[model samples]
Target: MSFSFLPTTNSTTTTTTSTVRMLPTRRSESHSPASRCKSAGHSSSSLSNGFIHSIPTSAASSTQRVNHRQGSLDQLIFKLLTGKPKCLAKVLGGSGVLNTSKNSVAIQTTPIVERDVVSSLQNCSEVRYGANSKPRITNITFSTVTSATGLPTVPAEPNKARSSSYWKTEASHSQSSNNNDTHGTSVDLLRKLSVSRKESGSHVDTVVTTIDGQRYDTKELDSDPDFQEVAEWAFPIFQISRKYPKTVLSRLTYNIFQQAELFRIFKVSPLKFFNFFHSLEKGYWEIPYHNRIHAADVLHGCYYLSVHPVRPQFGVAKSPDSLLPAPQTPAASIMSQMSTLELMALFTAAAMHDYDHPGRTNAFLVQVEDKKAILYNDRSVLENHHAAESWKLLCRTENHFIENLDPAEMKRFRYLVLEYILATDLKQHFEIIMTFNDRIPDMDLQVESDRLLVGKLLIKMADINSPTKPYGLHRQWTDRICEEFYEQGDDERKRGLTITPYMDRGDAQVAKLQDSFIAHVVSPLAQAMNESGLLPILPGLENSELWINMNHNHRKWKEEIESTYEPTTTCNGGSVNGVIEEESASTSDSPDPRRDSPSLDSELSQ
Candidate 1:
């Protein structure tokens, strides 16, 4: 079969009609006639009686010209069927339409046509025609044949034509089969087109085709060689960062953006997204903790929780003492019910929830009458400041990543972001947990409002997930946070203010403090999440790793404490009993050394 475009003119206007001609197949020199007949099938024999139908095209401007070109049958079929020039460009594997005038309509081929044309059109006829034969009359329409791209191929002969009902039935089945395939192909094509355009140094707007063949303009996908490398780094971001120290931040951001397919969904500019992330990264204080690294960790946690099955990871088992039944819902199911906007809000909130933190508690900021404390009436000072500062940075001209959002959408996004961020405040921790416990037992995620509440709870969980990590990582974070706390205590002491309990370098028992935190805060929340069916009881959360490690460290602290209490005896006598007697005598005459000096400072500071 061969196809050509014909330009026809009337006195009033001109039009171009595409004509397809089925020709007789002659046996190839390389193949015997029997082999040719078998390969070509009855379609070759039926082509002798096939007819050509003239379908009028919409009128084009006078300057329009029909460019007749010979190419692959796939290209011809795609060009004849797909109306969009962008689809044609993608299928043809070109950056764009080639050499065309203002009035010319480019017919580009897409990858979707590759398999469709080969399967459907190639086997369309069942009989062969002579090289020279007069055209015969046939009531067949191109619409039925064209629809075959989305339908099962029909075998046809000179005297047989299927009914429209049969064509319709096959078309429905074909559409269902090709839906996912077409969508995947479109995305691949768009990515390739994006890469090709960048390589060619073209600054033209990129036209991306969707699964249903709808086209929209998008910025070119990042063509950096590391883009793919970043996209494949899924989770445990801290480990990935440690492994790739230099590129972790960039990789993390790119991976999240690509995995969510946010670039395509939001039609965001790649440069703008990167600029926003860089600015947000810079906004974090270079403190021992509560910095960009923590933000990244939280973002990774949020992403994993959002995409993975939460039930198996945090659900209660069917034990006799279990408070809640095993969770029937999967985290992925809840996540699937969330809108793209909601997911974006959750991610953005996780990354910026602690922006510009000064490594001081809210109480310290309020007690010191810090400017930020006064700015928000000393209520959730750090949380309020983080939300405000992050939003302000996002609105800056260079970092307006969501500039394309409609006004209402932007407003909703801002509200969700601030809500999630504010929910991260430690002061609000109990209240959030209470709310989660109250709702989770009978919560139906099918309700949109319930899903939103769950999303908020997820961000909160992510904010404090450090304790749920592996023992080594958890220890590392504990050390970093303790250092930050100690620094704050040092600052407070230097200013003649009382040091907070956990922050006091001279008096704090790091292990005891962590043990208390795990028992009173982390464990309760984790238990609630699992028992309430909000999260599954995965090994990470329930296998006693964190508690065992914390207890081990606590025992070491107790040992050190006991060692500090050992009597400071002098060698007053050669015998051990005489030394104890002398030490008792010294202890009676002098102030207790243990009371005078604190051992926790030296041990914990180490």
Candidate 2:
């Protein structure tokens, strides 16, 4: 339906644009430019995405007040092109005919109007720098409306609010539909429970497991140390959710809680943590690991330290009689001095420290050409960002998790949590080891606070302690990291991005990188922590042939990498000291009964 556009006659209405009447179509029920412009309450100077837009009649004058906003305009244009492509082509075709039409003044005015409208539309489509990009509000403008209408050119303003709401509703509807298909009957229940849990207490509406039989609960399980740990890391969970409204923080938090529940039986911290995949956009990570689960595992490890009996066989002093003395006190007194509050602080730190990690190594961030790398000057990009974003999320009004605290107390709590979490960054590895090493009952390392020292040690221990996990669980974790790395690598490839060391996962580097990781990152850390007596709870460590499997895996990777790389360098007393004895007994004429004992390295290696 085409119509002629007549200029307004009233002098007072001269400043205000007259409303153009749009005809209804039988093709489909869609909003016309006039409708959208009117419903959206668009200003007269603003543009519409299509001939039909929702704007209030009152805002018809507002469209004439054109003050250009860069990205806003472009977004309006982009929406018009995508939403009404046919209309856009028609408008451009009409413009060509108008160039020779008898009413040339109208045509001349049309170009000026189109130019300003297009330029304003261009402003709306601008790309954000990083991390701070909010969901864009789309505007529908007049040139787009005219193109669709086949009417004489009429100026119209884009409806910002209504269009934004429409798109949001559409997105919400689509997401709900998708959830219904994937989740079946449980979708509605899950949704209800999810909403309710956020508003209410720890009471869960449902307890369900994944297709793989991994159980998840809305509440923490008591017997599950990992679940307890999840609760610990669930520090400022409410705050994080409130801060990042668009993100699924609650669901991710639940996932962490569930994973901790399933894997806590191992009593090893490493098995409780997982890696998060990163998206194409910077400063965002796909969930599953983030800080919540990582912190949860650390919390679990802390809990284990609190309750699990130290193996007396390892020379660990259970009572004050054998351990040591800080000052004017017996060894037992010193042990008792360590308070639960301090220990809880440490667990909280571990759990909350790496929340919302970007999944990129600090080195990668710095060495790469990304702006974030530049902003942080190449230091701990993920760690720094995580700390900042986590804190930001915590400060929101609705997410006040640590209730009943005064401002001073809150500040102290935040400081402690921040310090503990930030200290988990890999860059602090050397400092943590050196401090722990200096105090290992040999150097002048003062242990003023037993709980604080132990908490710090446990958190650090958990950070670098994945490979020592049970082979099945450890391998699962390893696979997740590889998945994360691959996702990042894929993004880099998409942007014609350069490959960073350790992040790239192409065929050429995959085996090489994995083998190198076993040698440098995994094995050494495992052996050192084991030697340092930080992880005495992992039963059957001597019998468990994880290191042997790691070594074997290393060999396989070397063979796969098309190179004759040597096995990873091992530290003194770290390697399997029993390797020679086991080999000798196996080859003996009369085999020792223990000849079949599993070598620690053999399990993980295989």
Candidate 3:
């Protein structure tokens, strides 16, 4: 995937056979909108964060409107890709192929090789900033040219038939061959090539020459020792889903790739992100129930389940000879029969189980009596809403990421995506486990082969277990969740609504309640998940265990806060504990918390 940066003074649209030739804008001009596009590329992936899976063509086309408003974002991407600050600025200020005002558009007329030569020369401009105080524009416009319309795509190597391993070995051989001959030059060229490959959708075998007169082949570069880490992280996910349809995975990957591109478009201004935030809030944003990462995880898990010596009571891959239907054969396969679509759905569902979570607990939504609560009649409001919203977002005809899918298969996809995401809600945790117990009537059968019922449970298991990922990652999740909670709490306080105790930071006693809640609820759930072998690779197991071990750690932290400010301890124990205990006592024959002064934290400590 070699990338070339092109520069030209032309900015006119010309017509050609079966396509339009859109000429470049002033490549040497400063204050160009292209400059804006450069900076926008930085956070493209993070911008699309919170979704399960996004289909490429559909997601991109659907978000074209969103992209238009974020024109400056494209400039940033252009800058990043080309490394031309001045040329980037000129492109952004309505001077590039991005003249949306023109009724007509132009396509590339030059051959790909010539374009590469030009693009490379223009790329040299990226390294310099003149004495003039012109702000570099990073944003630029992108116009897609279909191959069928005669536009050239990234060129592929004609006779490169070597396997991936062969290429790696070749790169290694080359690296040691010349200590300084071309190794360092090759490294830099390879980085640009990789980025270009990403942009042009080219194969890894592609080659691009850098300005430093160094030639680098991506295939050879990929064979390096350092590159192995990336391959290791990617291969497991790819191998798991390798059996699935190429289009599904391809589109999924492309969508994620574009999302990273789009993130750069809007991340420059916090104000720009606000529009993005509002768009998301107003419903343009949907975290897909089956997103990319989740799809990868579920597919990976499916592989583990498929090949595991030990099996759960019920789940997918019931048996090798179960005569389960094929996934693509959607109409023929009954819901009971496992198929590729189901597998994809399962994987997709797992990936998008918690797409775009606003991060508050279900209890917070219920206590605040949010509209979501009313919509769901206060029953699993957050869970129900997430599932509903994710589906609604996917239903748009434009966002039909699941292309080439039959109507019947599409319907099934929707159901599976919904069912799986809804099942991920914490409210259904206990019931899901119980269902697992019931579905697997025989212990022997449970361990004999992987059951579809058990696999479903495992899918849900992975979704909830996400927070248990790793200490640093898990803490990051916690922070996001806290941010969401605080946002909700702020809204509640502004509305003069009765806010959930710990949700509202303004409450003097909130810290103590939070500490206690962490002890009893968060820590315990994390521990249970770690012990269950479901999330064997969760982030902070060791650190969390240490935190759990110290009975006085949370208390001491709370006491430190209490020393500065005091408030009436509404419930002698933490509020969450008191509420849970009271609710439990009233609903069952259990003893009341008033009679048992032992705090939930104390109980947990024991």
Candidate 4:
């Protein structure tokens, strides 16, 4: 329990160790798998308000050989999903369970928390040997997701011919699990079939929603000239196309790449980009605010201020036909000053800054002693996870956008991405502001340090651009984020931990919280960037629009706080535009209407 971290052994056996602290948990059963060490009472750190780490033994070794036969991936996958798709949820995006029942199995998941995977390869076989050949066997060392189950750290044995018996067993397992499914629903992934009478050749998993009588789908979305127009601006219209978050994100990012010529300039493969985005989208948990939709919004915000050829006026376009991206040249904007590689890094960092967010703040994670916080040693835990995960995700062959870049350029690109993302941490908010405060007055873009600071500023702007948006747009974001905060508060209360300010469901109000956040946090950053002479940098920012929207939002919240609002339940979208005050307990004791919303753990490994 108090093992000193040993350096990697240069001998045949590898011993890579990291210093991980034990966690303090409210649950009596905190000896759960991911955090479970050999003994609970093994260290003084375990008794403190620290995170629970499994203390991955530096001694574990692997002696398995390589297996690169085709479809080996599929065979192992079949073995896993032979039951309900529980493993899919763990691998694809989440690990938390919101609702479980007696009849259902208390799900056990493969917790990918530690990274010290014991590799069998004795030499430098981690290099990609066949980057251009078939049987595309490359030796890339990675942390094992399977070994947590106490299985040997090994790849699939050479995919050899299997008998009919194997297929028969797999089929039998799948059939039995289907019969045991709750109302025919997969335990992890719920399924919904079409209740409508529309005749279709194949079942398409698409939900079509119409707003203001404007029907939105693939076909109509393309024709709705305004859809693309909205994508060009800082404040994008996500509510109008919220259902297709992944699709919308892909399209907007694709278009932005085209406009900036990132694909051409970086020699990025479109197919590879598509694969990367798909994986990235799947990794996003369906949380209230940090979901895929939020990713698209940030992408819009980042591109609009940092790379758009033209910055449109601070007004919403009534119709697609009416709103054209302003024809103004990039002369006044920072877009003209940036290199294409920098633009790619910025766009990528934007899309992935909150990759796999667990809907809880880093403070919450540290308080709960979540493994990620312990692994990161409680220092910018979430930001560090985001940077590490984003890089790891991008380095996958299918998502390797920088593969075409020379080694130096690729390293530079990675540095920029990591820097931009790490700067999004709210813990460093004052530091970033202070640094910008010193530099913005007479910042010289010609200097590398100054440009790096600007990149950080741009991402920070995008991360908190919600309050600076139009009232309706801003209101929607507030409700969603407040719901997320409220969820964290509920967890904290249940665990008997101190709830963060403006997070408690019984105490937090949208108006009050928003007013405080905007005044103390949003305004200072916006003002600093505006002085940096960046292109009305964040749209909710320039031409007085930023100040106008910010003040309007603040005043609206203040007025609401002064008056009484009808009580509504949590996560209900309350009155559609504003957060409903939780009804006082003295009011009728009708059963609470709040339902369990999903908040899956993204870092069983953030």
Candidate 5:
């Protein structure tokens, strides 16, 4: 199929016609104007491929106008095909037939089938029409019916002459498809670019690698054989302090990371865990009874209670002193109901509960007007400091262990930590015990709040479990606490300040204090927990050897007091010691002179 135009003797008159024939691949000799047309005003040019273009001319002025019209037709065709009308026109007008001043008129093309137009011009390949041709448009192929900027042109599908609306619809569809492809390609390119940039440095190559189905960049710590050894160690609390006492910090890190892996709750890089543990350990003050070792102990206690099923130990029979009416439910059944996240929160709170403690009681701090007391307005000063400082450390870049947690999970984690840590304050002890006492009968471990309350009580039990340890360990902790208290009392005396009770070095009796603590605090707490069936009789409880040792120590204190002085009634009607008076006056059947003594009751209270 081809088209041609022939001019008559008068330039204003022309005829256009079409012919259909099988296009041959053979080239033909270029035809001159006179050869193609004998009309005096007609001129023709034949392409090597046998296509003819004819024009009409009268004089020099009309010939220039004809050339200008030819150039305009060429520009319009190029623009319709390539979607850049002005760019092609600018290039051609500068140097093509339209460059002459007299050649300023534009030509209009006859109606053409849209499909044929697309098939004929889809090839954007460059072609040189003449030596003077500056911007060629031939021999180029575009895969889609659109230009470089993704704008649609003619449709590739063959169709008869279609309305402009039909072409517009097809063009819109083509534009949408092109846009989708371009957007997808752009995203893929960006991803590849990011990966390449990250991997470009040797540092990245050295630090990041896969391990046990996760990636870690922890300075090769994960590869260390010792890490595996320590991680797999059973009973980390017992082993950590005993085997590697001086390496408490390292042991804690290994244990925490190992637990995270064991429970499958840790999904972050090992580096983050390591950094958090390091910062946490470094934050603890080196106080005698509340140092890193104690923190590790508390953490170990929490971990033990969390994972171990409450089973009775061998060689230990049911204690006659157990507050439970019968053999209550096993501790394992209650512990089994706690979630992995709950266990993690409990362990973390234990490890950080006493962080940065100054080895002083809250009461002492308040009475002495210590800076911390002033900062916290004399309320839970140490507890508040621990929670705040520990949370701050976790927020640092390297120590963000929980950074991957979603917003809700993170908020829950923070809440658990704060609740458990603050519960350790002794001022809250009576209230917590009362709450537990009230909730024990119908306590359900399946409820999250109930389970959390249990966790809180467990942490408190662990905090004060020192006196329930085996006699040797019990003595060690007791001495440490006493020494800490006496130091406070000594400071008080040096400043001529009123000495805090149980803290005065000269008058404070260690055995008497232990006895009172066991009777008033430890015993009642254990009884409440046992009745609630929330905890089993662990090794260091009132039903274990700890209770027996406590009684023996108490008896020894009683014997010392009795032998020290002769019985006497003072003008105040009180005995020399409070404990002696309470035992004699409360238990004795015979009415003594001080039986109804108000001063005796007052002295006993103090």
Candidate 6:
């Protein structure tokens, strides 16, 4: 990125200037508006800031001059930067003389008049601003430029806090060879809080130290170098989060964004993030399941699918990344398909997908005709509520993390968040699996629709991914979710409503439920993800490791549960093997899991 601000008449002058350039605007989601900026000449022109905006494709070099204010060369250049916000990072980087120290820019004012400046900006096709107009702007050394409330627009590389030894082949694509240990840059945003604990030098936690303390208190995540090193390859968050449970969701969410370099790319202030995620934590009901822990787990799963699909094969091989697929391979390609903005959207949606859940499933909400069900018209009620409430939190000034995005990017981000979160509705579960199975063979990364379709699947899979985790972790999730379901059943019994299947307190089998859920929902999604090449095949393994994990959990239920507990009716309501449903309720009022899911195939095709 380079900027050349001076014009043709003063070509002989030896005064040096930076080369200014703009990359093509990326509006893969919300089709960028037809125009990036209004006409160059405005009814009122003031000289205040830096460089001229890259004229939009529609605004050709039309030199129609309008009313303008006469000002010095500094004001004109300054005005171009201040006035033309659409120029974004490219134009700012090109201006070699950025006054980075204070609010003002330190531009060297030449005798170039405002008329010529405006003319040059309008007729930009031919005008050359400096000695080397198209030179790279390497000297533009500012890592982040941010407004008080806005996130950083200039994105830095992802966090490289961990050692590079265990990273797969994907690192080579974004990382430079010169930098040996180029882990994503670690900016511990937790230190920015004005809390007294840090000032007193007490060896304290990032925010709070207890379960009863403020959940919204923004905390430092993984300041310990030892933990970070292990985080690179040890176990997933399903285990780690349980060990350090204090503000775990908030910290885990921060780490995900930190690793992705969302803070640098979006220019989000660390302090502001504390408010956003803590609010999310506060919003999560402290239930048996669908709590903050579950949200954090899903976030971890989604990010891994997008960025690090191939886990390094530890100890088994001399080189940890040897089993890693090549960058061009289909399995590896899915890892790199998502853009940073899309990553931001995916992760944000993941973190808040189940926000404000009331320990009830969508089926229960609709069965009871709960207010939320009415609000969403009884379709995907809980999911709609989660997305809607998360947006409300973002709407608050403290949690305005993405305020810096342009209208088009902002709109695109909202669309992504809504679609990703909404996909969590169980009604869309089989529909998404159907789509994945239908499209997996020829999935095209170049197509925006295809990319988003995969993103939705990723979030949905993440929501239900506990079954594919380590057996102990998977069992813990099963216990928690069953407890929540039973609690809802208790409430249903009190209200005199016929309890849905799997909610029967007396006869409901936890082990049977786990086995049935795995066989019906979890197994199919895992198969689709594996066949799609999103989950890479492990070295010398026929199926993905996740597939094996699910199978192991399924087998454990049959071995330990059915033999131990009573199993009168099968899970599928069939007489033989168990299914997802626990009882065979013949009443019309009881919600049918099969009928609840309306077809999404017609909607997806559109």
TM-score of each: 0.56, 0.43, 0.38, 0.53, 0.52, 0.61
Per-residue lDDT over 429-499 for candidate 5, one digit per residue giving the tens place of the 0 to 100 score? 66788887777656666556677788988898878776545445666777877877788778878989877
Task: Quantify all predictions' global Cα lDDT against the true fold.
Answer: 0.51, 0.37, 0.36, 0.51, 0.48, 0.54
Give lDDT tens digits, candidate 4, residues 1-606: 111221222244333222222121111011222322332332322212232222122212264222323223223223333422222322221121212222112222212211111111112132111222122111111124423223233332222221212112111101234343332344334221111222211113122332112222334433545455653443455754465655666666766776665553443555556557656766788899888788878878887776443332222223557556634423345555555566678888888888888988876777789999899998878788878887788888656656655444566567778888888876666688788776554665544466677788888888888877877788788889989989988888899988766677887667766655665567677766654445363343334345445655666665676674544422222121122122111111111112111121111102
Query: Which candidate's TM-score is highest?
Result: 6
Ranking by TM-score: 6, 1, 4, 5, 2, 3
Residue 496 in candidate 1, Cα distance off native in Å? 1.3
Candidate 1: regions farther than 4 A off? 1-247, 312-334, 536-606
Q: Which candidate model has the greater TM-score, 1 or 6? A: 6
Residue-level lDDT tens digits of model 3 in 65-102: 22323344333333343431233222221011211211
Taking the tens digit of each residue's C-alpha lDDT, what string does model 2 give over 60-162? 2323423223223323323323342223222221111111111111111111112222334344432111222121211222233333224333233333322
Compute the lDDT of residue 213 as modeled in candidate 5: 24
Provide backbone clash counts, one per model: 25, 82, 85, 8, 6, 31
In the range 240-273, model 6's lDDT, one tens digit per residue, is 6667564667777777776666664454555556
Best by lDDT: 6
Q: Which run of 10 residues does model 2 get worst, by summed lDDT?
A: 579-588
- Indicate the worst ten consecutive residues by lDDT in candidate 1: 577-586
Q: Pull out the clashing pairs in model 4.
A: 22-51, 23-51, 23-52, 112-605, 113-605, 226-320, 540-546, 603-606
